[model samples]
Target: MSKTVTFVILLLLVIKTSVVCRAQCSQGAIICETFGSGPRGLLPQGITNFTYRARACPDDGEYTLLDTVSGDCHGQAWHPILEDHTPNDVRGNMFVVNASYQPSEFYSQKVAGLCPGVIYEFSLWALNLNRILTAGACDEYILRNPIIAMRIEQPDGTLIKEIIQPAITRTATPIWVSLSMQFSIPTSSNDIVVKLVNKGLGGCGNDLVIDDIGFRPVHPGLSIQFSNSPDAETTVCADTRLSLTVGTATGYISPAYLWQQSQDNVTWTAIPNATLSTYAINPVRPGRTYYRLRNTQSINASAVGRAQCSAESNVLVVNGLPDSPFSLGPDQVLCEGTTQAIPAPTSLPAGTTFVWSDQSKSQNLTVSLAGTYWLETNFNGCTYRDSVIVESQNCRLDDIYVPDAFTPNNDTHNDQLVVFHAGAFLTYSFRVFDRWGNLIFVSRQIDVSWDGTFLNRPCSDGIYAWTADYSVLNPLNQTHHFVRSGRVMLVR
Candidate 1:
């Protein structure tokens, strides 16, 4: 083929394969599509001194668009019902869950300027509600965000709380309510969790749109610091050493490090040579507690530390659950072809991950096959664990059996034999033969007893040979195999 022709043919072949592979993919999975930016969907960007017609304080705006199937879609407002609506009026995005806050996008495109102490102001047209049906549909969502969590926050002055945004109802003409909030952190938070939120509904994962998010400034020393981190307050196995980080300022470099922690954040105790980037949170106590970094220099422009450092990383919380205490839940046998969900509790402070002894992460599982299962959850800190077991549906075998040897001599008792499964379908075959590999009587699913009949009536008993065949699984991948051969005796 010519170069041009070859390239065209190859390109066509590649495109054809790509399309077929995605045939069962999401693009093909969508059953329906609709478009309506809700009362929250109204954009205020174009009109300065925007004009609108609202008859009441909590008025549903006029000249707005919304969906009949989905409720008021908007951003900026506190949705009372926590539905996943795009409040930003952006056409393409959906809502998703994080533990604390219900955010706007699953793939929230980078907001370019997200950093420490920066205050981001949220702005969007919120939907005025209660005009629409506040009552939930029969198909309200069932949440499903199951995660192994580790959250780091300087919860000191920063009001760091997980948020679940409500889904709002739709009204006539869909009125818009504008809502706004701000968040700022002075320092970095370790163990910051990036996770998903389950809406608990039938999977209504909604994400909204966000615009005009910016950083606002706060004062100095307003930042509180934590020293002995990740294990802010954790149960450590005997003699397990703890480590916490000491931070320098956002802009400047500190000459040295000083670590001070308290049995409480109050009454102070100092570690003699704890001058380093990370300190050993020692003289470890029992039960719950807190710790903070001691700055050698005062945290002010005129003083050394504020010019040098301010906030410690977000506080780390470690819980020391009892040693090797195993846990498991969803204690039920799952049905075939359906998934059963099992939840891991947050009670175990040390355990960080889960493993099925059989290597399955099936917190929720479809018991398609029968197997013995166990769950092993681990502690990321010191190697500790908790584990449990699960059982699956049983499989059955087909019965097919017949007598190897039989004497049809008008004998009454102990004359014949057969095999069968207690409750199931059956298939069978039986045969009798002489030593020369000649078949005497052979039949499949033979219901009548063999009477040692070569043709009919009784026959003589000798070392006559025979063959029997039946079906059963080999316990492997459940394949079918046949067994053949044997010898039998007939008596007169």
Candidate 2:
């Protein structure tokens, strides 16, 4: 081989591998191609056999890159695609191709820099872009389905794997489907050429749109959860410990692990001696912390924290609350007949809740009796308590009133004798007598009155003596009993 011939061959090889892209993938998988962004022009020369078109629609043996698909084709026989298959991509481009009249290679690219002896996955998203109907045809099986052959070859053109994908048939609506194959890079080769060859001829159908082509390592999923909590995110008091566990992962012959911590989710630090499926977090400081697990092969220690080489678990967030600073005030004094409101706790964490000794969650506790009142606040699996001692004292006295004179002339004014007192009366009794000491009127009821008549006969209207006994309660809840006598004049 001449020097110029070798140089030309190297140039062609470089062009073949230039289409391989390292885009984002699910869970750190490597997406080789997403057809670039919207308004993309054309593939570099030699990347595909099909001629490239700048327009939205392509004819037979031609292809194009478009963000969205619309308009009618072949008498409105094709389905319209509203978006590309790339996730979270508002205007990502997709490969739209119409097969040629004969079976031929349509796309080819050489993937390089693969890790040998590692399992890798090759996949793509495909959509059957045609919606054809056969006259009176059942099962909608009128048009020719799209079929393609995924061929993998070593750099020396040695075949490694070939998968004949099933024919993508037409449906009532356009749907994007996924097709994938897994392989291990042989020890002798670290690069391979991937080729997509059309297996069906183009005519009334066999049209398809392809997007999100990927070539990545096959890693088992890693999901981290709190061992004691059903939720991944939780709050804890200051200086609290936590236990975390990862879902069982398969596929690695000798799995290695490392536990990592982060103040914010963006930056991570590996924990010393924390290499297992489960990890116990030490007492966390005040603030938010995040945790995750990284898994790789035991032989690949250097790649343990590298996302492209290791499988990372789902992030677990822990919000650490600072120590609570609050007081319920000093011992309080209350009167027996009065109530006082104890203020509620303020400036506590979001999830903190409290309950009083009476099992009430009201904003404040109303206390009237002398006792010990307590409040217990529960926050992030911890409890705090405070109490106040209440004492009662006598503050006011009960008063009583008795009439001095009355005339039972049936004029409706001053016709009877009555007794009155404040509402503190607990027990009462009254009696009336003439000057000869005869019990003319006796009563035990507080509201009863005397009319200056006994046995339906009018008595001589003279001074009458009245005796009464009663008990009254003060503000201190203590009852006081007293006996008294008074004279009343009655005239008819």
Candidate 3:
């Protein structure tokens, strides 16, 4: 094997040895042998060579299952353990054994249904039951500690992993210590046989209790430390770009690397082309973002295959920024007779402030007169600014139409003398005069027309003079006056 492979094995063993009860396999166990709740009994005949005892206390070369071990048993050679190590249980049985006078293989089980090339953790909880003193309270003698060899092997007797557990010596207070080992199944093997061989000689104090044996897949122990900060979480200004450097990565060997990011922490997406150990982002969009490094040890470059056997580093959080950057759009024109409304964004984070050029505090800015307009958005103590130009367009400078003659004989067609203007006028007046200069018809509104009537009586059909005066806005939005006169012939 290569040196990198050797280092990986040694590092895995060293890291797993220090973990306590809390560090069970996070991925669920495939082989959970709790010796679960049942009537006090022994394992099946073919499973182990140890004889079965029906009582609470088992003698030498014997094993039994019970929920609790009484203090009166075996002349109080073992601790009175109340319950098994199974979590969240009212009554659970623990396998209690007394080593024989000679060394022997005491426990064996065939584990199957495992995926090849995947790493697995084999672990169990053990408590040394030997009392501090011998049978007599006044007599002090050396007690025999229970030492066992944990082994994993192929069904054909090929050894895969074997380690001698340190002797479980008598402590002042009996507590369960977790013993765990990590190994990967080779492609040639799909099933394994696990064995426990007692190394301690049967004696006055070689009894122990076992519970919660587990076998589950585990990810490699991949980790990283930040270069600039010691914490996993930090803050960045909204206006500045974010740059992160991984100071130290555990065993930067031949493993393939891929970086991932998450917005909600539940769903993660792989960063594109981010295969290096360092990352830099400019104009970092706001919000809380999480990043992590994933390491895969594989010869194949397939993404799905790599993800199956990948290890992820601890998540690094960058938090407390504003919303993403926004644009105010291109410059626009506002007609003289119309109003335009520009609204500030309301979905920004709390305490966000918006300031317009005119010092208006409302969420919407309404304007008629045109000029340059700008806004400053402040969030998380950072400011973003954008400006836009608003120029004026005259609405009343378009063409107007007036007919020179009309037939006001009460028919729908050509019955009224109406003036039409395409553009809006600020002020208007129209009047019709008789040949003798008498005011026959008058109107101040643009749409109102003269229907050839005066004082509710029809006027005589004749030629008459008319005049119109109106004020309209010019290109500079200034009002300009115009007067026009025309002679219209009113026919019956």
Which candidate number maximizes lDDT? 2
Best by TM-score: 2
| Model 2 lDDT per residue over 153-246, tens place | 8878888888888888879899887887887657686577877766775456777788876666777776789999979899887655788987
Q: Which prediction has more favorable lDDT, 1 or 2?
A: 2
Give the poorly placed runs of model 2, Cα more than 4 Å off.
1-27, 32-38, 44-46, 68-92, 113-119, 131-143, 171-175, 187-191, 202-204, 214-218, 221-247, 276-283, 320-492
Q: Across residues 117-224, which tens digit of lDDT does each residue of candidate 1 receive?
A: 433232232333322223344125432221111111342323343343344333444343333334443445411111112232222222221221111122223222
Pitting candidate 2 against candidate 3, the one with the higher lDDT is: 2
Please give the TM-score that candidate 2 achieves against the real structure. Answer: 0.51
Clashes of each: 42, 0, 0
lDDT of 3 by residue, 271-365 (tens): 88877767765656567888887765443233312333456678888874664356677887898779998777665667778888899878877
TM-score of predicted model 3? 0.49
lDDT of 3: 0.69
lDDT (CA) per prediction: 0.36, 0.73, 0.69
Q: Give lDDT: candidate 1, residue 124.
A: 30
For candidate 1, the 10 contiguous residues with the lowest summed lDDT are: 1-10
Model 1 segments more than 4 A misplaced: 1-52, 55-243, 247-282, 288-315, 318-492
